[model samples]
Target chain A: MSEELAAVEETARRRGSRPIVWLAWFLLAFFFVNLAGIVFSAVVDSFGDNWFGNWLPQVWTTHYWSDAWHAYDLGQVLQVTLIVSVAVVIVSVLVGVPASYALARRNFPFKHAIMLVFLLPVMVPPIAYGIPLATAMYKFNTITHVQIANSMFGVILANLVPAIPFVVLTMTPFIEQIDPKVESAARMCGASTRKIFTRILLPLLVPGVLAASILVLVRTVGMFELTYLTAGTDSETLVVKLFDSISGAGIRAPQQSDAMAVLYMGMMLVLLVIALRFVNPTQLVTRVAEERDA
Target chain B: MTVAPPAPAPARRHRPPDPRAHLSHRLAERGIDRTLWLLLPGVVFLVALFIYPLAYGLGLSFQPLKSTDPLYNYKQFFTDHLQRDTIGTTLRISLPAALVNVIASVPIAYRMRGRMRGKRFITTMLVIPITLGTVLTADGMLKFFDPAGGWFNKTLFALHIRTPDQPVLLINNYWGVVISLIISGFPFAFLLILSYLSGIDPSLDAAASTLGASPRRRFWQITFPLLAPGLAITFCLTFVLAFSVFPSAYLVGNPTSTTRVISIAAYEARSVETNDSKASTIALIMAVIELLVISVVLFGRGRLYRGSTGGKG
Candidate 1:
């Protein structure tokens, strides 16, 4: 009996290591699959005529990169994307930070409702709202004496609609996490609400604000549907530009398209890393888990 | 999502007076100051630009498409092909995609949940793909899945399958869209859910384990119930994001075989057909379907729609 028990124990302990090995192998497969997908696309783009057929691009060259650098002319779209993303972040922060403060510290009526409205912006599909948004932009041209439909500002305003809710969603918790006693302490010491908000509360909440801002920036830069609808080809976004380049007026341009795709991925990867440093995806992921495990 | 928050009532004191109220209350008690209300500019901005545009779009559904037509744009929309498909297609894509994404993402999300080894690397990799917009990822998929210089071709030929002449897999069809949605959509949704997963009270988990429940049982009885609401919200949000597929279809799809989301139809109705009212109707129809899905998510699963805001202090 003792010998048999020892064998069971050994097998159980030994069995544990195999599953771990299997798991490691599986994860490696996922990584390989995804990485191969990306690199495969990148490597294939370096060739011509052999886009989908060649085992290896019979002719590989860095010509796509050198040639691509000059022609895509992304300066304008980059500027527009930057301006809109930054503007949305600033505007969302300015608006969301204060509201989150009020929501957090104050015992207000309709608290749930307000938050719902705050979240409502992102609740439905952006495209669903975009049709009317396109029209609204057209109408705003007459009323504001600004051509919002085809301009960057219109896109920014549109961006804010989806972006602000995210800010409120993220920052609300950060503000709530800070003890109200601290806010009260500031008040007792003669800090105005504004002073308290700016000096004490704001400092404590920078991480949350930064998270919200970075997320807004990333989403803003990647925005495609609204821009496609609101902004014409004349004021096309990089995504739209990429789309046009591949599927525009002529036959498909795979090499150029892949190069542009690489360019897009590169820019976004840089932004995401920068954004992730301040606004770790952990917090967002945590929120998901909490909601699911609610 | 079900009910709006009640109006903010006056803050009440517990033991008569909390010391700080006197310094601030008297001056501020009489109706909210306009300046104090400035916190609302963002709200108003959304209302005006986002909400207003959506409302304007919705209202147009009641009006006829043509000056001579006497019916609501909505009535005609449902009667028509493009608008009819708007709801059907939106639901078709969102429901199944949400299901597939949720299913496919679970093992990955679960593996990513705890302090497992390789968790960080897996997470970083999962997340990296999403940083690029749908357009970029969809476009890159072409080279990866394309027929000529595509990666799928290269790999298969290397493996001694059929020649590289035909190499398209789910690159630009319905399956392609589904694949694209899964790759781009799941990480965002998974990350959202992972945060909630980590937030499950450890006490509840501990107590369940102490009761002699198996891991699967504990998860279903204790963990999964708690997760349902968060999952619902995540599902709806992701469904919203995914069904509104625009850039992907525009970038990689074959005009006939590859692409045709409702948004594309709306764009076509406006740009190609020169029918703005029809476009608005299509948009409204899409909104209605999405709203219905959200409602089902909120109501069917015995879950409450609480914002992921509050506490953790």
Candidate 2:
């Protein structure tokens, strides 16, 4: 019995020290350390002056933030971003909610095909379609004398393609969760169709609408390729302007770009936290990918 | 007697007949057929914005300038070394980075599955890089992995891993862009894998262990087979995400020819060279490649699980 107990203890010890387990822990630790290190470096460098050849900055200053703010015309950029984001959200909801209701409540021909049509915009990379879209916008602008290209309206329109689809897909699921009988009951009470939608359906769907809008807000703020391709001089959003400053062919201070990046990061962090509170990351990913499947 | 008359005959019956309710009643009598009209605006928006642009782009790709040859732009893309190399460059960075991210996420996700302390917190932290977007991540990489005065080099120097003058070449090359892709791509891959792993029933592993199977044996026989489909899906999604990398490659990479992804080529062809035809050609080619990769992954996934009886050996 004593010999058996000793052998079991030895096996347990060996298993605990297995190389694979150690490697797993080590890699996890490395991942966290690297993640923390990179974020910290950016934050520190944004505030540092002359941070070369040293482990830490010799002097810290808020001058880089000011420089990035003024040099990038961030005030205008923020206003444009706000306008574009809000416009995209409002339009997406207006177009998406009704469509979502139809998709959820009605059985139509080529319903699956229509859902797939919505899926294409989200699945494909923006750059693939953005080039031609931008070209078309320019052509449209030239012909119609309506500044679609290189203008705020153009950016908002371009964003609406994916935003509307996203709203439709997310809202379809929400609409499906609600009982259809509620609308029927309102109709039975001699209420009009519009009244049923406004009083009975809208109140119940508000939470879903809010969640969808918040998500669209996050996506619109982070969208780069389409906006970059279509935006004009005065319509550049924060991401586009940041890209221009960084990739532009000129000698600029690294700290200033770092500061701008920090600002972008801060904004995204706030938006994402609010988003995560309302939706699960896993659920969001699967929803975006498998909505058609669902 | 006056109360009995109640004035109802005059006022209640003739109160405009409630047009709102009347209209609603008429609509209800028509059934839900009008719901198709609700779908009109969205369908029109997609067709106008999404389908039209893609179709126009495809059409534009075939029309070459100064030549009637429909394949002129495509032939040029294949023959030109700089343009042709973007495909190779994109694959080289995307494939390995995506593989590493998906494979690395497996063990960590396996360990993280089920009830655990700080799981929510750790998962939230993992998602930060993804939300930070590629531009910010590339900027962070530029600062943290700087060759001259960066902390990574300084730390290596302090630890006697290299001479003070000879810091490791981390940025401005293939590895730099790969690291940035990994940074942004890993969070997405990790979250995906975590969700996949959580879907797997833990009782299978527990049953195997009770039957005297070691942890490795249980994972290989029970867990891995079940996880293969999710892994393939995760790999494909991450591969697509990495394959489309543009800003990060330009920022942290030697963007001249070494890291000129297809998107960069498309951008230049349209913006710099004013050649919309060639730009469309490159974009179409990129789309084709992505579709082929996705199909191959799906095919492999179908094959892997076809013979198994619901993941049973």
Candidate 3:
């Protein structure tokens, strides 16, 4: 009786879902087509000599890429970007992984409050917190005579605000998924806490840590507001440089901006591909939803 | 006699040292074991970098640089039409964009909820915008929606909906920022909603269907209510994202008038005008508004079914 009912329901579902499925496909295609068109337009413009009212540029050239690289001082920008992203990734992972273990494994007082504190940066938009953060950075610079507000150190510090929390958020689920029995087994075998962490947990946590670090690295690379607020002239990252080229008061060619944009997109795409290779697309956000519910 | 009595008492079995006597044991009792030392660096980092600065900024907002009145910055912001109107403009752009993104994401996320063959490919494709970030998306929008040769205008030209002379007014307008927000925000909303939708057990729907409920009826009766809380959260997240839009507004919208959002106003106050106090005040206002919206949505979520919908996250 249940089998017959299930069969009937399955047929009805398949029949009823056709239009809805088509609509879903249409929406997906529409979205991707627009996305591709947007990226394609930038790519073509970056290589094109001039674009007018036409389907494609009449001429194509690589000069814009060369021009943008030199004109924007992209070598220095890329160097700064690399330094900041790497520093942020290392620091966030180092700070976040153990904290994730604590949060995941221990039932502690004010656990929810602590989680909220960690989640605040991820939940709040950057500018909401960034303004105050930048102000404090500038103030610190004046008081301590340290170049924190606009220096590379300042940029790393500001980016860490979000990056560290992101690491914690991503790593918590990974830690939770590891069975507590394994740790207990090691403990019963006379492993000290330090040995348990260094020998057992560390090995188990490699993939999670790598995924977290790569995600943080990508986030740091693209972080604009905090970087914009805190970075000095010499500390600007690629995204910030890209923004300045677009919005700054200067007589710059459109193609040069397009070229820089294409370069920025390429770097982000590379990081994203690497990130997605290790981390499932769903894994990126599911943990966050779980965190919210918890 | 006293000595004999003491000896006799000493013969009683000695209690093993109380486990709680050790600091580690006591801390463990309170859920603050040695393992918690690992949390120290992150907690300290956040306190110094995130919490302290925000607190300092709040304090700074109360200290006007040029005015004796503590409320001077706040007053000036409210009194100034340009600055005050930004609250409205930001809302105008963000509210609808967030709503649209959340609404658009739900149907698609529902359709794509369970195991599907191309789910991974589709999800990865949707995630492109999120990775693209705002600046690139704005650049893309500029070129793709350019009046002279943008593909959008070109499409309009092909469709005869518009001509080269009068392309769809997408870039550097109110709508442009909203569109950019939707494009960047929809992917996030979809990912979030999909995760939430997948959290609901399929058996409930199957049960509903077995009782002879139609697909539409089952969705409204069972799935929609279950999804309400997640939708509220998705809305709040997207709203916050759109509300704090800066790069897109600067790159794609009319910054001075049409879409001079609160963040841009705060930026100008801090950077352009070099008034940190005023910037902090505006930043506080922005945070307040965002919290207000979030709390309202969450309050609505509280009214929904509070029990677990069955699938563990």
Indicate which candidate wins on lDDT. Answer: 3
Candidate 2 chain B weakest ten by summed lDDT = B304-313
lDDT score for residue B214 of model 1: 59
RMSD in angstroms between candidate 1 and the native structure over all alpha carbons: 7.2
lDDT value for model 2: 0.83
What candidate 3 gets wrong by more than 4 Å, as runs, is: A1-7, A17-19, A288-294, B1-24
Q: Write the per-residue lDDT of candidate 3 for residues B1-313, one digit (tens) a residue.
A: 3554443455535555467597776666677887788888999999999999889988999899999999999999999999999999989999999999998888899888877788889889877788889999999999898887789889989999877787788899998899899888999999999988888988899988878898888889999999899899889889988988999999999999999999999999988899999999999899888888889889999999877877764
Best by TM-score: 3
DockQ class, candidate 1: acceptable
Question: Which portions of model 1 miss their true places by more than 4 Å?
Answer: A1-28, A43-52, A66-71, A142-145, A249-252, A284-294, B1-36, B65-67, B70-72, B160-168, B202-207, B254-259, B303-313
DockQ of 1: 0.45
Q: What value does the lDDT take at residue A62 in candidate 3?
A: 94
Candidate 2 collision pairs? none
Query: Which tens-of-lDDT digit does each residue in A1-294 have in candidate 1?
Result: 256754554354345345644664585476459655765566456554443354455666777665654566667667766777788789888987777666666655566777778877777777778878988788778898888888877777777887877877777677766788887899999999789878987688876777777777777777877777787545666776777776652554457667777777777888878866765565533321112222
What shift in Å separates residue A273 of candidate 3 from its native position after superposition? 1.5
